[model samples]
Target chain A: MIRLEDIWRTFVMGDQSLHALQAVTETFAAGEHVAIIGPSGSGKSTLLNILGCLDKPTRGQYFFDGRAIESLDPDELAQLRLNEIGFIFQAFHLVPRLDATANIELPMTLAGVARKERSERARAALESVGLGDRAGHRPAELSGGQKQRVAIARAISMQPRLLLADEPTGNLDTHSGEQILDLLDGLNQEGITLAVVTHDPEVARRAQRVLEMRDGEIVRRISADEVSDANPIFDRGRVGKRP
Target chain B: MKPEDTFGYAVNALIQQPRRAGLSLLGVVIGVVAVIFLTALGEGARLYVTEQFQTLGTDVIVVIPGKTETTGMMPGFTGTPNDLTLDDAEALLRRIPEAILIAPISMGNDTVSYQNKSRQVVVLGSTPAFFELRGIPIARGSGLPEGDIDRGANVAVLGKETAEELFAEENPVGKSIRIGEWRIRVIGVNGPRGTHLGQNLDLVTIVPVATGMRMFNRTSLFRIMIELRPGSDIEAVKEKIEAVILDRHNEVDVTCMTPDAVIESLSAIVGTLTLVLVGIAAISLSVAGIGIMNVMLVAVSERRAEIGLLKAIGATHRQVLLVFLMESLLISTTGALVGLGIGFATIHVVTWMYPAMPAEAPIWAVFSVLALSVVAGVFFGVLPARRAMRLDPIIALSSKG
Candidate 1:
């Protein structure tokens, strides 16, 4: 489970402080599948980064499993990310120098896993993502969707309780993008909580819950029961019209 | 991560960048080879001088007339006011029982002629003790007979090479040779004594001291050579001889030198020369260190994405720093090992070229060079690794430049 209380993120350029995320609050229980949808600069990625423990909130607090993250040191935060949270970046941030299996094994290597066990678990992780045949391919050699799968395997190799995906299908074709979403949906049904940020409404259509962000704040929320009545894509079309 | 794992990673990265690693290695190898070969040259010169003096005799002392000043004023080939004589040498021989053999020397350059063959050679005049003190043995015929000091025999002894040149294959014993104008009969031919301190030992002729003084028209001996009894306290003998000479002459114009002093001074000079040469060689090692640092900094910049990925995977700032440092250690450690082999091979080549040069590097010098290379690697490794450690994961991950 995750909880955010008045979270804020500010960036200072020159003498000006830009509020990237402002006074955001939310909670998601275990096994809840959610999607954050908005146009560019809506603070959706910033909120997901805060949830993943990758970036600290500039104001207020975030709690994961009843533990406040703002009070933790850098080493403690790193431990939390290692064991409890997994992040899937829009860019599929797999190490270019490593093969698919080695890329998946990196998180466990940092966790002090034995070499033999790391290899075995890395192979299993690759198989789970339907990338077993591509274990020896580097990111440069892999297709975009294959690379994204390896990145996914790497993220979940440690069996984190929560997965935060930031525009996970942003760089893929429609077909592979569908495949990636199907894989993530299966992981969520298996009891791992998932949070996906996306501009594509089709990807948002399958979420159990949806949150719409604009101007550094969450402006709308649609639960599973009300999902069919609300069209988030139609809302984005209305916002672009001139008065 | 385990240390073995860290090392394995480091080795893998170095293998990926072979040209960069090899260029750094070249710097260290050149430095080490220079140090080994130059220092061995210095040691070889020291050993050569020590061996030459030892072969002469440890208890041998040579007393020359006139003081050798610390300034640029050396005792030249001119006669001194308080000249050393045969009587002064005899006085020291009589007083010190340790003085087992004393020979008075008179030397000059002359043209010795035989029928149609003539050559210019060094003519040395001394008693029979000269052969014992100078380590020369006669091959045939008798040496200078006893009691010849006062009688001044007109007998001549030819050096091996000199005898061969003037007589061809003929026997020179009992044969007469003309030295300037005086006719002397060859009494003996010295066996080959090779070369010492670059002077050919077998190109000289010898005669009795009294005859030499008459031939050169000089009364004072050029130098007095004394052979002390084996195991004699040379310092005590030197003091006693100086005291007797000072009493007879009443001046400190005389300089006495023992073989020990020569050897000690020679070693000191060689030691300093070796250090200076080794220091010059160390500059290359410093250059190598700087090269490693430059390459590592570029590596950090080029691999920023990889660094970001590792940090995301749970690597700490310290682990990132250690990885870069370990990479440098691998480079330098490999360089040092290869450099040592290069140095050793160079020494062998030098010894092979100059068989008698006696070049051998000290074990400590070899160990120190290896240690120096590793230290250079780690020392210069710090700056780049620190830069990598301080990098922000967010900025690094997003940076396309």
Candidate 2:
């Protein structure tokens, strides 16, 4: 679960301070899949960053799983990211020097997991993403879709309750993007809360709920159940159907 | 995280770019090598000079007619010229209880000729005890005779090199050679004992002290060398000798020197000089430290994305700093180890070229070089690592995109 109250993120440009997010307040329950949709410079990524605990709000209170995010120190916030929150960036952000398995194992490695368990779990995570044969490939050696899958595997490897994806399939082709979305929807069905920020309507349609934003304010909210049959192929998505 | 695993990551990072790593470490390598080699050189020179002083017998003491203000040897500058004669030498042997033997030496550089081959040479005047006191072994015939120091015997002994130069391997004993203004018969040849302290022992010619005194036309002897009985207090004998000579000369004009004191002072002067050289060599290490700092700054700036990525993966600021710091630490320490081996190899090469050069590095020199390299690493590695630690993760990561 996550809660926000009047979150304001400001940026100083030259002599003027520009407010990227102005008095934004929102909340979401556990296991819910939400998509934040906006054009460029609409504060969608900024809101996601605040939710992921990667950055602090300029003037706001953020609560995650009953703990106050503003009260946590930098290291505690980092711990939140390491254990409670999993982030999948648009760029994939796999350490270029590490192989896919090592990339997937990074969060657990930072958590001081033993080498044997880290590798075993990383391999299992890779197998879950259908990357069992590509565990040894580095990011530069993998395709765009494969890289995003590895990033997804890395995010979910530590078994975090909340997954935050900021345009995770933005760099990939449509087929790969659709497959990634299907994978995300399947994880949400298994009761891991998911949030995705996207410019694509197809991605927003797959989320159980969608928030539309412009000019640093959330302007609309919609539910996929209310707009059912928007995409028939994803209607069958669930853990049991995939396995 | 486990330290072993963390450092393993650092090692792989260095290994990924071996050439870059090696080039950055070159300054440390050169610095450590210079430290070892220069210190060895200084130590070697000290040893060589000390060995040369020790070549003359430890039991012997010299009474020179001078007042030396600085070092003990070389008695020219402020000396009050007076008699420290054969009589004074004999008086020490008679009056001092520790006096066992004495040799009064008078020396000059003059021309010697044989079979139209003439060379300018150093002619020494002393009693037969000079050869024994100085450890010059006779290769052929015999050295100067006893009681003949005052006899003014027209007999000469050729150095091995002098004899070979004058006669080309022919036996020079009983042969006549012109020394100064007198024609003397050669009675012996000194063996090859190598040069000592830059003095050419191979070009020496020895005759009776009276002959040398008369030939040089000198009234006072150049120096009086006295030998003490074993285990005798040299200071006591030196006082007595000084008392007798000063009693005669009516002033404290003569400088008394124990052979060991000369050796000690020689090593002390050389040791100080060597320290200066080592200090100079240490400056190069500082320069190398600057080079390491420059390379590390470049590495940190170039790897900003990597730093942000590490922070994103939950690495702390201290951890980011340590990764960059490890890069320099590994470089300097590894360079130091390599330089040590290279330094000793250089010493071997030098020793081979000049056998008289005792090019052995002291144990402390090797250890000091290793410690210095690590210190340089820490000294220069701080700034760049701090810069990396202070980097904003969001800015760093996004900047790369």
Candidate 3:
């Protein structure tokens, strides 16, 4: 579970004070599939970053599993992120020098996992993302879809309690995007809390709860039952169905 | 992290850029070669000169007229423009109790004729004790007798080389040889003393001092070579002799020297020359160290991404620093080994080529070279390694390169 109480984040850009996050309070319990949908500069990514412990809120309290994250040191925060949270970036920030397996095992290695066990777990994760045969291929040698799958494998390698994906399908083709969405859905079904931040309504529709934002503030929250699950596949053939 | 693991990573990183490592090592190689080669040359020259001095016996001292500096061209005569007459020699013999033998040597270049053969040679006039005093011996026939010296006899002892050149297979003893004006009998043939420095001792002829003075008729002075008694320290005897001579001559413008003091002065001059050579060699070493520094800086910049990735994966800043430092150290140490091999090979080749050359690499030179390589590595590596360690991981990961 994650909790935020009156969190405010501001940035100084030349002469102006820009508010990135404005006194927001929110909570997400375990096993929830959530999406924060907003236009650019609406603080959706900022909220996700805060939840993943990548950045700390300027004002107010953030509690992850009932512990105050604002009081933690940089090394402790890194440990929290390593042990309890996994991050997936839109650009897929994988170390280019490492092959897919090494990239997937990176988090485990950082956590001081035994070499043999780290390899075994990384292999299983890659298989889950359907990239078992491409374990030894570097990122440059892989396709866009395969790179995303490798990223997905790396994200889930540590079996973290929460998954934070900041536009996980933004750079992918429609089919690859659908496959990535389906993979997230499958992990959600296995009871891992998943938070996705995206601008696409279709991506938001796949989540069980959708929170829409405008101007650094959440404007609306829609439950899964309130939204129609109409298939957008017939409307846009380019946006294929999840496999 | 554990030291072993850190070392493994450092080794792997160095191997990844073999060309860069090799370039860095070139600096160390040049430094090592300069140190070893220059020092070997210095040591070799010193040994060669020392052995030449040793060939001249250590117990002998030469007393020349005039101060040594003032008598540059006339090293064997006093500056007063008067001969060191036979009376001076006799007076020195009586005054200096430490003097066991005093030889008044008169030398000049002349042609000696035996039958129809004639050759230019250096002729020396001395007493019978000259042979024993100067460590020269007769290899064939006999040396000049005391009677020959006392009676001013017209008798000569031919040097080994002179004997072979004039007489060939025939004995030269009891044969008449023409000096400048008079016919002198060849009483004995001298031994084979071989060449010392550049002077050939075997091409000389020895005659009585009185006969030489009468035949040449141009001597106001002669060189007084004194041999001290056995078991007496040469320095103490030299001081006593100098005091006795100064008292006899009223301490005016006279110069005396022990062979050991001459040798010491020569060694000091050689030692200064060695230092100058080492200084010139150090210039090359400094250039080499600069080359290493430049290459290491380039490596740091090129490996920025790898450094960031390592840091992101839990490597500490200290580990990163240590890795780069170790890479530099490895390169320098390898270069040192190569340079040492080259240095020893050069010494061996030179020794083989010139058997008479006494050049050798001492243990201290080898150790100093090794230590210098290590120091140079650390000195050139620290700057770039520190820069690499201080790089920010977040910005580094964000950069495209």
Candidate 4:
């Protein structure tokens, strides 16, 4: 479970201070799948970054599994991220030179898991993502879809309590994107809490609930069925599935 | 993380960019090679010079006229107070029971002629003990006969080259050569003796000290060489010789020097010269360190995305810094090893090519070079590693690598 109380993230540019997120309060329950939908610069990514512990809120109290995040030192925060959170990026963020298995084993390696266990877990994670045959293939050799799958494999390899995906399907073709979405939905079904930030309403449709953000504020919280009717941004043909 | 894991990652990172890693390490390689090769040369020269000094017996002490100043100015710069003569040499033998044999040397350049052939050569004047003291062997006939050094002998010992030049194919032992006004009979020919300290030993003609003193028309002897008995304390004997010279001349005007002292001073001078050369070579290692720094800085900037990714995967600041630091340390260590290999191989080739050059790197220099290279790599690595470690993950992750 996660809770954010009145989080504020501000960025100072020379003489001007810009508020990216203001008084944003939200939470996600255990084993729940939620989507945050917004246009560019709407603070969805910023909120996701804060939730992932990649960045700190300028002002807020954040609780992850009943532990206050703001009080943690840098190393403790790193440990927290290592043990409790898994992240997937739109660009797939796979180290280009490492094969699929090695990429999956990276986080565990950083966590000081023994070599034999690391390889075993890495192979198992790769199998879960249906990339068993691509274990030795580097990112450059994999399709965008396969790279995303590898990234997903890496995320779930640590068996985190929460998974955060930033536009997981943003760079993939429609068919592969659908497959990645299916894999993520399957992982969510297996009892890991999932939060996805996306512009695509189709992705938003897969989640149990949707949070619509605009102008650095969360304007509406709706169930998955209410996105098409209640949210106005997708009304302008942005809701249509990609060709 | 485990230290081996960190090591593995660093190795993998370097292996991923083989060309870049190789380029970064070249400076250290060259530095180490220069250090090893140049120090070997310096050490070899020192050894060669020391060996040359050792060829002269360590037990022999030479008394030269005039006192040498402590400032190392020319001897007798204050004044020419006394001339060391045969009498002073005999007095040293009488007063110091440690003296086993003494050779009073006198030298001059003059013309020697036998039949129609004539050549200018260095004519040395000394007792028969000169041959024994100098370790010269008689190849034919005999050395200067054991007789009174004060008595002028008409017999002469021709050097190997000097006899060959004057006699051609015929033996010159019984033949007589005219030196100015005196006809000196050749008693012996020295063996195949080579040059020492740039002096051509094989081109000199040896005669009795009194004969030389008469021929050069000089009243004072050139220098007196006293060979002490074995196991005799050289310093004690030197003091007694000085006392005898002082008693005879009324002033300590003679400079007493044992071959050990000369060899020691020479060894020290050469040793310092070797260190200076090594110092100059070590500067290259610093340059190599800077090269490592430059390459590491570039690597840090170029791999920002990877750094960010590592951080996102939960690498701490210390871990990130250590990874980068490991990279540089690996570069320098690998470079040092390659350099040492190349240096030793090249030295081997050099010694093979010229057997006379006893080229060998001193053990301390080899160890120092290894330590220096590692230090250079790690020292230069810190700045870039810190930069990489301190990078903001958000900014770094978003930047195009």
Candidate 5:
């Protein structure tokens, strides 16, 4: 569960105070699949960063599982992020030196998991993402699709409640993008809350709810039923598969 | 993290960049080896000289007539020289209960001749106690008797080598040798005493002090050597002897030196020389430290992204600092060990080459060099490690350079 009340985030650029996020208020219940859809400079990534505890709003009250994150120290925030938040970046951000398995096991290792347990858990995570056979391959050796899968496996390795994917499919081919979206949808179906930040309308259509933004403020909120009818692409998915 | 785990990581990291690590360690190795080898050579030389002095009777004290000054324009060596006559030796024997034996020595270099052999040799004039003080055992003939010294008899004691050179396996005792114009009878041959302080002890010939004074036309001055009573404090006896000499010579300038004082002075001079040598060697260590620093800085720059990644993965700032610091420490410590090995090897090689010259490495030198290497590592490594640790992770992870 996550809540933000009247969040305001500003950045000082030379003489001007630029508003990255302004007077935004939002909430998401557990197991909800949501998408924050906006064009470039729409503050979607900044909102995702705040949700993932990588950054904080200048003026806001943030509550995660009933704890006030706004008052937490940097260390405490970092610990919370380490334990409860998983991020899938557009660039994948896998350590180049580590293989897929090591990359996936990194967060658990940081959490001080025993080596044997970490290996077992990392193996299972890889297998779930259909990358068990490629565990020994480094990111440089992996394709764009395979690297994203590795990133997804790493994100869920800790089984964190919230998964934040920023443009998860932005760098992938169409087919790879579809496979990545399917993976996220499957994870969302397993009762894990998912929030995706994307500028792609097709990506935004995959979520149950979409919050469209302009400038630094949310312009509109569309329910899945309304968006599915409004966008023809969602109708094609409904025709081909059971929702 | 546990210390063992940290150490394991450090070792693994060092192993990963073997060339860099080896290069870094080479600096320390050279430093340590230089320290050990140089120090060992110095210590060995000191020991050899000290042993040479020790062979010359530990109980003996020599009083020379001279004034050693620290500055100029004052009393030079020409100051009223202490008149240490043969009577002073008699007075010390009669008054000082600590005096076991007294010998007055007068030495001169003169050409000596035998049948057809002629060579210049040092002629020593002293009492019979000179043989006991020098630890020379007569090989074939008897040493000077008390009667020989009292009567100023022309009896000579030929050194073993000198005898072999001059007499060529012929009987030296009962033969006569010419010193300048005086013909002295070879009454005895000294045992082989080897070289003491570069001087061949056995090569010198000894006769009576009175004979030497008569031959050289020198008077009222002689080097008085006194051996103290067994179990007696030499320093106390020396002070008492100095008082007696000063009273006899009316406190005129003179130099009196005990064996302990001589050894102490020698050790002080050796220690100063060692310090100067170590100071010079330290320049090499500084160059080595700078080499380590340069290598670490390059490593830090190259690993910037990895450092950022580690930090992002929850490695604390201190942990990042420690990783770099440990890398430097490993390099320096390895170098120091290599240097120490080289140093010991050098000493061993030197000893093997020159069996007569002692070459021993002191334990303290080894430890001190090791300690210095660690200090150099930490001192030179901290800057680069701090620079690496302070890098902004977000920016670092995003950096393309």
Candidate 6:
């Protein structure tokens, strides 16, 4: 379970303050699949970073499992992320030098897991992602699709309750992106809460629920079936402009 | 995280960029080698001096005229010090029962000519006990005959080099040679006694003490060398000699020197020299530490992404610090070991080449240098490790450079 109340994140330059997230608030119940869809500079990644406990809001009240996130120290926040939340990034983010199994075992190693148990769980995680045979392959040796699978395996190796993905399929070919989406859908069906941030409508179309954001504020909440008609959300202004 | 695990990770990281690691290691290796080799040389000089003193016999004590006080001037120049005469030497032999043999020494420089070959040599004046007391063996013929110290015997003993220079192929023994205005018979030639404390013992000529006093035209003896009986208390004998001289001259003008005190002071001087050499060598080690610091700083910036990933996964700041610190420590430790190997190998080769030097590093010097290098590693590693520790995971992960 997650909750936010009047969350605001601001960046201060020498002469101006930019509000990345302004008076925003949202929540996702346990085991639900939600997607935060927004164009560049809509603060979607910022929101995902906050949800993963990787960054703190400039102003907000965030509660994860009834515990106030603002009250925890940095190390405690790191511990929570290590054990309760897993992150998958657009770049795969697997350490390039480590093999698939080592990459998968990394978080568990950070958590001080036994070597034998870490190996066993890494193998299982790889198998679940259909990459068991590729456990010994490094990121450089893997295809874009396989690298994403390894990243997914690394995320789930710690068996976190919630998965936070920031542009998870943004770097893949369409076919590989579809396969990654199917894998994520399967994991969500297994009762793992999933939150994905993507500019791609096809990625949002698979989510059980979608929230469309504009100018750092959530503009609408819709079902996955309504994602095709959500183009007007981007067409409001500067649709082709880079942030 | 486990310490060994951290160590393992650090080692793995260093292996990734061996050239950088080796470059830093070179600094420490050179520093350690310089320290070991230089200190060993100082220790070798000390050992050589001690060996030379030991050969002269530890039981010998010399009573030199003039009180050697720290007057900030040449000894005997500040005061009209009494001379050490043959009477004082005889009094020491009479008063101190521990004096088994006493040889009063008088010295001068003269040209000894055998036909046309003439060589300037230091002429030593003493009885036959001087040869026995100094451990100077005879390579040919016999030493100075047993006679009274006051009797001027015309018989002379040639030093090894002195004999070679003056006599050429002819046997100098039983042959007459003129030393200055006095004609003396060559009774013996000394064996090859190498240089001791810079003085060449084999380039000297020995004659009767009275003969040297007359030849050099000196009324007082140069110094009295007293050999003690085995198991004699040297300190007690020295005190008795001083007392006898003070009673006769009514002044403690003569300074008594035991081989132990001479060796102790000489060793202390050499020890200080060794420390100074080591101190100079330690500067290079500090420079090497700076090199390590430079390398670690570069490594921290280069591996920012890896550090961020580790922190994201659950590595604490302390763990990150440990890994970086361990990396530097490993570099210094490897350098120290290699340097020690090279230093000892060089010392071995040196000793093999010159067996008399006995160049070897003291045990404490070896262990302390090791400890110093480790300290340098940790000390220099701190700043870079702290930099790595304080790195923000968000920025580090996002940073492209």
4 versus 5: better lDDT goes to: 4
For residues B1-401, what per-residue lDDT tens digits would candidate 6 score against the true structure? 66666777788788878999999999999999888988888888887888888877888898877777745454435466777777777788889899888999998999988888899988989888887787788999998887567788888999999899887888988999999989999989999987864668899999989889999998878788888998888888888887898899998888778888889989889978976887787789999999999999999998887787777666777888988999999999889989999999999998999886769887776897799889999999999999998897766776553
In the range B269-354, model 5's lDDT, one tens digit per residue, is 88998897689567777788888899889888877766765555455567778878887887888888888878888888888998
Each prediction's total of clashing residue pairs, residues at least 3 apart in sequence or on different chains, is 0, 0, 4, 0, 6, 0
Q: Which candidate number has the best DockQ?
A: 4
User: What local distance difference test score does each model get?
Assistant: 0.82, 0.81, 0.76, 0.86, 0.78, 0.85
lDDT of 1 by residue, A29-128 (tens): 9999999887677788778777866678899889898899988887887788788888787678887767898889888877788999999999999999
Tell me model 5's lDDT, rounded to 2 decimals. Answer: 0.78
Docking class of 5: incorrect
Note the residue pairs that clash in candidate 4: none
TM-score of chain A of each: 0.91, 0.91, 0.91, 0.94, 0.92, 0.94
TM-score of chain A of 3: 0.91
Candidate 2 lDDT, tens digit per residue, B1-401? 66766676678777877887888778778877887888888788777767777766577788888767544547744545676678777777779878777888898889999989988988989988777777688999999878745688999988888899999968999999999789999999998876854757778999999988888887778888777888888888888887887788887678888778877887788778777867865798788878878888987887787777677667777777777788788888888999999999999999999886787788888878888888888888899999998887776766553
Candidate 1, DockQ to 2 decimals?
A: 0.31
Worst 10 residues of 3 chain B by lDDT: B392-401
Clashing residue pairs for model 1: none
When 2 and 5 are scored with TM-score, the better candidate is 2
Taking all chains together, the TM-score of candidate 5 against the true structure is 0.83
lDDT of 6 at B268: 89
Native interface contact recovery, all models:
0.27, 0.31, 0.03, 0.51, 0.07, 0.32
lDDT of 3 by residue, B1-401 (tens): 34554555556666667887777677677677777877887788777777777766677777766666765654544346345556677777888787888887777778998999988998888887778766678877678777534357888899889989999999999899987767999999988887664567799888888877776784544577888776677777667766766666666355566667767987898789777866765666667677777877887887776666455444556667887887777777778899989888888998899887677876787886778678877887789889888886544543444
Q: Could you tell me the lDDT of residue B125 within candidate 6?
A: 92
Tell me how candidate 2 scores on lDDT: 0.81
Per-residue error for B38 in candidate 3, Å, reads 1.3
How displaced is residue A150 in candidate 1, in Å? 2.5
Each prediction's TM-score versus the true structure = 0.88, 0.89, 0.72, 0.92, 0.83, 0.89
